[model samples]
Structure formats: C-alpha cells, structure tokens
Target: MLNLLSGFIGLVALILMIPAVIPLLGALNWLFVPLALLGAFIGMLSSKKGGQNFCLIVAAFGALRLFLGGGII
Candidate 1:
C-alpha cells in the first residue's frame, strides 16, 4: 500500500535527512526536530497497520535512544 511505502520512506528520511543534509548546509539540529516529528507522525498515520508498526518502531527507537544517551526526553 502507499501508506506503508510512504511511511517507510519517511522513516528513512527522518533518520537520514539530518546526517545527510545538516553538515553540508551548516543547519541546526533544533530546526530539524519538527521536520523529524512531522515526518514520523504523518508516516505513522498513513494506515492502520502502518500506524501500529510506527508505534512499535517509535517505542524501540525511544528505548534505544534513552539507553544509549542515558538522559531524559
């Protein structure tokens, strides 16, 4: 489905966009948070199954980030 495809693409974009675009452009990370959130939310809301998958993906990512960074969100 398009939802699934879009969500997957968005996730890739969310993860890769900053690392790929920020350094060369001298962009700030603060500006990227909204973009990442928007992409992840829209990507997650595309379909029922995609929503569920996105929820799981978010949880996993959060846990990993928390553990690795050892800080509060």
Candidate 2:
C-alpha cells in the first residue's frame, strides 16, 4: 500500500543520511531530508497507525540530520 511505500522510502532516506556528514554527501542531505519529510507526511495520512508511527520515526531521524548538518536553522 501507499503507506508502506512511503514509510519504506523514508527508511531509505534515513539510511542514506547516515553518510551525510561527509563533505561529499553533505549536500545530498538537502534532498534526502525533504524526501523523508514528504514520505512521512504521506504515511501519516494513512489509516494504519503502524505505518504512520514508523514513518514518523524515520522523519524524525531525517530532521535530526537536517539540523545537525545545518540544512535547517
């Protein structure tokens, strides 16, 4: 379902952010952070609580990366 897909994508984005502290990958966090947020939003709209909770956790991770990486103030 769409919820699962969104959560999966968010999870992938969270994984991708793992290396974002490196100079080469730092720029990509700009893209990944938003992608994760979008995925979380999509998943949040799902009727299933499980998917919503999972994606929200992924989104939180992405947000943490964004903040630590200086992508957001």
Candidate 3:
C-alpha cells in the first residue's frame, strides 16, 4: 500500500515536471524535486525497491534540470 502510494506520488511529480522542462519554466523543477524526494522517502518505508527507484529517477531528472539551469532559468 505504501509502495503504491509512493509510486503514485512519483508519477504525479513526473507529470508535473513536464512543464518544468520548458525553457523558461525551469523554476518548476524546484517544486518537483522535493515532491519526488518525498515520494522516495515514502517508498523507503516499504520493502520493495521499485517505487523508491522510480521516485529517485524522477528526482534525479529534476536535479539535473536545476543544475543545467544554474538553479534558476
């Protein structure tokens, strides 16, 4: 149940990250990274690794975007 919830949260964050990829919308990734990290934390409470991994990947993307944008684009 927790794993499922985590996955759902990660999915939502990933979807939200779509707009953040736009040239001038990089600031949105600031919101996405935390959300994804929260999902990853929740996933850590579960035994399975899948949800946690998914959330981590989403967070990584957000972090990469932030890095590329120099923390603000």
Candidate 4:
C-alpha cells in the first residue's frame, strides 16, 4: 500500500519534472524536489525496493536540475 502510494507520487513528480527541465523554468524543481523526497520517504517505509528506487531516481534528477540551475533559473 505504502509502496503503491510512493510510486504514484513519484510518477506525478516525474511528470511535473519534465517541464522544469526547460532552461528558464528550472526553478520549478524547487517544488519537485521536496515532493520527490516525500515520495522517497514514504517508499522507505515500505517493504519493497521498487517504489523506493523509483522515487530516489526522481529525487536525484530533481536535485541535479536544481544544482545545474544554481537553485534558481
């Protein structure tokens, strides 16, 4: 159940992240990173690795975008 929830949230974050990758829109990642982190935290409470791994990868991408944009773009 928790894993399912985490996966869903991660999917949503991934969807939102798509636009944030734009050169001038990278600031959106500020919102995405925390959401992804929440999903990751929830995934961590679950018993499986799938959801956790998914959320972690999403969060990593978000963080990378933020870093590339210098925290604001």
Candidate 5:
C-alpha cells in the first residue's frame, strides 16, 4: 500500500514537471523538483521494487533539471 502510494506520488511529480519545461512555467521546476525528491524519498522508504524504480527515475530527472537550471553545481 505504501509502496503503491509512493510510486504514484513519483509518477504524479513527473507528470507535473511536464509543464515546468515550458518557458512560461519554467519557474515551476523549483516546486516540482522538491516534490520529486519527496516522492523519491517516500518511495525509497517503502522498500518495494516498483516504488524504488519509480523513485529512481523521478530523482534522476529532478537532478537533471536542477543541474540544468543551475540549482546544483
């Protein structure tokens, strides 16, 4: 149950990031990145294979966005 919830959260975060890619919504990335991280953390804590995979993907994309946006150095 927790695993499913965590995976769903990660998937939702990824979906939210789509709009953030647009110039008008670019600033939204800041919000989405944290959301993604939260989802990833929750998923990790769930300790389920499916949740872990979802979290990994979300984390990777979030990190890439942060790096590209100069949030990370």
Candidate 6:
C-alpha cells in the first residue's frame, strides 16, 4: 500500500506540473512535484503518524491548488 500510494503521489504531482499558466494563479504548480516525492518517501519509511503527516501535507497542498486556485507559469 505504501509503495503504491507513494508512486501515485509522485505521478499526480508530475501530471499537475504539465499545464502552462492560468488566469488567476501563477507557476507554483511544478513545485509540488518534488514535495510529493519527498512526502511519499517519508510516508513509506516513517512511523504511522509520520506517514499520515505526509499524506496530510500532500492533501493540504492539493487542496490549496484546487480551492484557492494556482497555475503553472
């Protein structure tokens, strides 16, 4: 489960980095790619709480992009 989740996280981050700019947001989308990879590793290697924490981080960032609206520039 950990490995699968980690891979998925990285994949999602990479995909998000593909678009080119938006009306309201900026180019901060690609930044989450590395972050997601790191979080995935942390989630796979650390304690249960640590994994949860990483997942929370990923979720929060994703939420920010979706809710607040951010773009790739």
* Candidate maximizing TM-score: 3
* Candidate numbers, best TM-score first, in rank order: 3, 4, 5, 2, 6, 1
Cα lDDT tens digits, model 6, 1-73, are 6655665565566556445235444345546645675656656664454544555566556545644553332
CA lDDT scores, all candidates in order: 0.47, 0.72, 0.95, 0.93, 0.72, 0.54
Clashes of 6: 2
Clashing pairs in 2: none
**TM-score of model 1 (CA atoms):** 0.34
For model 4, how does the per-residue alpha-carbon lDDT over 1-73 read when each residue is reduced to its tens digit?
9999999999999999999988999999999989989999999999996888899999999999889889998
The candidate, 3 or 4, that scores higher on TM-score is 3
Between 4 and 6, whose lDDT is larger?
4
Query: What's the true lDDT of residue 1 in model 2?
Result: 85
Pick by lDDT: which candidate is best? 3
Clash total of candidate 5: 0
Candidate order by lDDT, highest to lowest? 3, 4, 5, 2, 6, 1
Model 5, poorest ten-residue lDDT window?
20-29
- Cα lDDT for residue 52, model 5? 62
Each prediction's RMSD to truth: 6.3, 2.8, 0.5, 0.7, 2.8, 7.3
Q: Please identify model 4 stretches exceeding 4 Å from their true place.
A: none
Question: How many pairs in model 1 have backbone atoms within 3 A of each other, for residues 3 or more apart or on separate chains, i.e. clashes?
Answer: 0
lDDT tens digits, residue span 36-58, model 1: 45555665556555633553454
List, in order, the clash count of every candidate structure: 0, 0, 0, 0, 0, 2
Worst 10 residues of 2 by lDDT: 64-73
Q: Write the per-residue lDDT of candidate 2 for residues 1-73, one digit (tens) a residue.
A: 8788787887787788778766556666777877777786777777775656676676677666666767643
On TM-score, who's better, 2 or 3? 3
